[model samples]
Target: MTSITKRKTFLILTSLVSAIAILLLSLKPDTAIMDDQTLYEKLNNGNTIYYLVVGDSIGRGAGAESRRDSWYAQLERLIKKRYGADMQGQHISQSGATAFEGLYKLKNTELIYPADIIFLVFGENDRKYMEPEEFAKHYELLVREAKVRAPKAEIITFIESPLAVQEFANQIQAVSSHYGATAIDMRKAYRQSGAEVKSLNRDQVHPNGKGYELYAKTILQTLDEFPNRKAPSTKEALYVQEDAPLHVTTSIETQQGFLYKEPYWTTGKKGSSIRYKVQGNTIGAIIKRNPNGGMVDVFIDRRYYRTINTNWPLVKERYIIIAAGIESGSHQIEFITNDHGHRFNGLDEKPFQLAGVISATINSKGTAE
Candidate 1:
């Protein structure tokens, strides 16, 4: 071949390669919002999705007037419509469980089915239990187990909605981060929906048909926020199952108790005692404790943080408290019960939210609103 011809062919191949690279980059997300664990990388079409849905009645589709309009069904339908509705290998889960209790199920049972993906939903019931630290431990264990079980399965942990619209908004994402999984913030979707979305939600908690429709659509759209993965198709309805629940959780209705009375923190004086309750095997907390301002030694989930001078860093506790590590949710910064004796005895027995979800501009990756 002539030298000129060879040069021209080389240039053409190089240009094609560069164009392909550019296309792939454009398609991929600029940020890693989902599971940071690389397990979610796309695979061949034949690859099966043996999924396991874990959590409360939502997983069981309880609030739904019919089984058809359930969260699980909606999620499944969305998955199927996008992925050709391949249902053979998937495992439908419905354990009347919460977060802490979920640890046992995740570890002891075969529910997590060895598939390419596992959808973990909990925290609602755990909120009732109020053992956020233990729940954090269990969550970490679940992630470890999932990685061990599938090694390749992408773990997606969905944060359950709190009883009030303004609760637990920051928690789920932090916990997800500790486990090295992707944390999809549904609250953003909820917020985006505005009052109309709130109205669609049944009893201020679970979403109704309209609510579910919004939920499914927002979630599906968020899937695009993931990597260069292909979905089943846009033709698939946002979610399957028709009917849905029109009421809030009965347990939440009790309104008889709060999650923490004496939360475990790291800044208790030496020998000071910090107590936290173990609710439903997990702890659902809206921690907004800022230890950077005092000389308190932090005590939480078997860990400690030393605040030198007035600057306090978060001591290792359960899940990640959102709003710059606890500018929101339920929290209280207090001294240990026995600071004089250099021993700690946790907090009082009556639980109440010391603080609530304060609006934060830099909630994710330091992004400000």
Candidate 2:
């Protein structure tokens, strides 16, 4: 009960509290990126900036504790802040996806969302497996494909550290130059920025938290060189399902076809036919695959486009392209079940199983600024 005793206890408690606060601060990110209120304002008052990030595990944040802590996430935050826009981040980077697979994946996203800016971070998986020349060609194809899919989108090819040696980096540079895309060498950036070696994750292939922070910083700094495009005052997005009113079909059945959490999947009979009228340059489908599935033919505007096989041993959800690089106006997409020469006889009952459809309805007012 003595004054000195009470004062000593209070002092000890205050010291502990101070230490705890410092520890907590150290555990948090170095600086506050953005708050919910700021993000809401950006989504409402600002323009719409659709940002797409594609690549392998590196871009997928394999080494980071949380994916939101990745470089792309950080860059997106800064982009929204600087441009004052509703920057929608579309990340299609899978862990094991290579350049070739990435291309197909990109093709799969044509109608889901049209990106305004695209960041391609690949090459880690292709290090020892593919030749530099071949990889470069494939990289070029990917860039060209992105250009064809979203002509107005800015394509950026980002090369990461340690593994991006001279030969590999040169290939990437060649591809970027050929396609008129920008390539950022993170290794050079890290060195010039004076980041430490500890930024590398314990595995050394991927990056740690600090490394991702530096990565974001380097990318943001590079992007600063380009002028920010003036987006529309108001933006709109649309996602349509196959069974929606837009579809005019005879054979395709709209019912609970798959186990996934979806609205409806268009199950195809032997002679099933489904059609959708969409208003966009790009078109794609959300499909489900199973061992009992078959092939389906796709047609764009009455022209035979391509045939997609929906047969797989395992069941999974997939995004498939119906059409891209078409004129932005009223268009029709038709799907017909083409089940023939079946290796698995069990698929005779159920043939084509398509999940949904998606499209981003861009304004016809004017081109993206």
Candidate 3:
């Protein structure tokens, strides 16, 4: 080939390589807004509703002065102003949390348990370390975990900044589809007639405040009906039988997290009337359903607090732990309802114990109850 032609070809190859490299680097997961360890700490108790939004710097609101103006913050403000004061929420966006970081931060931090709603915006960072296929794998894992941890929480995947372009969008679609999450096309919203977001981007990717204003408007519009609906009901089917022991009556409107079934796990039919006999601290034999002939384990801090031998029936004072599983700090405990059933095999936790009983004697950072 001619020397001139060879030189031209080399130039083209170098330019292509550079562009591809730039695209990958821009998509790196570490570049996300925040990860679990990256705490925004904007927790306020004014609202009864809570949301956990995760993703890159945009999700973290790097462009905003105090991280509060970031899109997530703006969303919170809108919710509080428009919805009411009882809509408290949190933003856990890290400045550079990639998709991988999201899995760790979300799962380890236990946000899923408390989160009534979730806005997951990611993928820009995953582009660097993985192909769309690989990103999809990890993304699926994250979704599965979310399902297990936050069964009631509705997850919405805010499509990554569309300004970054199509390749990323396609990856997001594939991954979101594999995981059964809602894929909100932020790109389409940003490009809508009234928004000037494309022009307000600080970089071709990140946007300035004006840019976020457009983003926020689009998000708020979608979220307008979010708070109006009731939280999800339990998907697990509950069966109560004549001889059924340990039956907990869960209301149809239960939210997706921990539920407390009360001191007597077994709940009798409302008309039948459950009776308990107290023998001092230990519960004496009593009957609710048919007759329990197994040992039901109770939880203290989720670690075997006590056990009840159903050799007889319900005993009021039976195995009520003195001081209720002494917790020295903020702690959690739960018990399985089926543990008392002869053939129960659903749910990891049916009832949970709160800090209602703690006192200075139990928790160092708390008062004695």
Number of the predicted model whose TM-score against the real structure is largest: 2
Each candidate: what lDDT?
0.43, 0.62, 0.48
Over 1-369, each residue of candidate 3 has an lDDT whose tens digit, in order, gives 999999999999999999999998877754342122111121222334557776666777666545565676677677677655344456656544565556545655655336656777777766654455445544555555566666656677777664264666776676556555567787777666455664657776776677676677776676653443332333221111111111112222212233335542342111111211111111112112223334444444446555444332321122122222133343333333333333233423212222122111111112233
Model 2 spans > 4 angstroms off: 1-46, 200-202, 228-369
Write model 1 residue lDDT over 309-365, tens digit each, in one string.
222133222222211223322232222322222112352211112221112111222
Q: Summarize candidate 2's per-residue lDDT along 174-284 as a digit string, tens digits.
A: 767656677888888768866577655636687876678778877777666754443212111111111111221222322222222244344545556776666665466
Q: Over the full model, what C-alpha lDDT does candidate 3 score relative to the true structure?
A: 0.48
Error of 1 at 189 (Å): 1.1
lDDT of 1: 0.43
My TM-score estimates for the predictions, one after another, are 0.46, 0.50, 0.46
How well does candidate 2 match the true structure, expressed as C-alpha RMSD?
A: 14.2
Q: How much does candidate 1 score in TM-score?
A: 0.46
Candidate 1's clash total is 33
How many clashes does each candidate structure show, in the order listed?
33, 0, 34
| Runs with alpha carbons beyond 4 Å of true place in candidate 1 | 1-47, 83-96, 111-113, 163-171, 195-198, 228-369
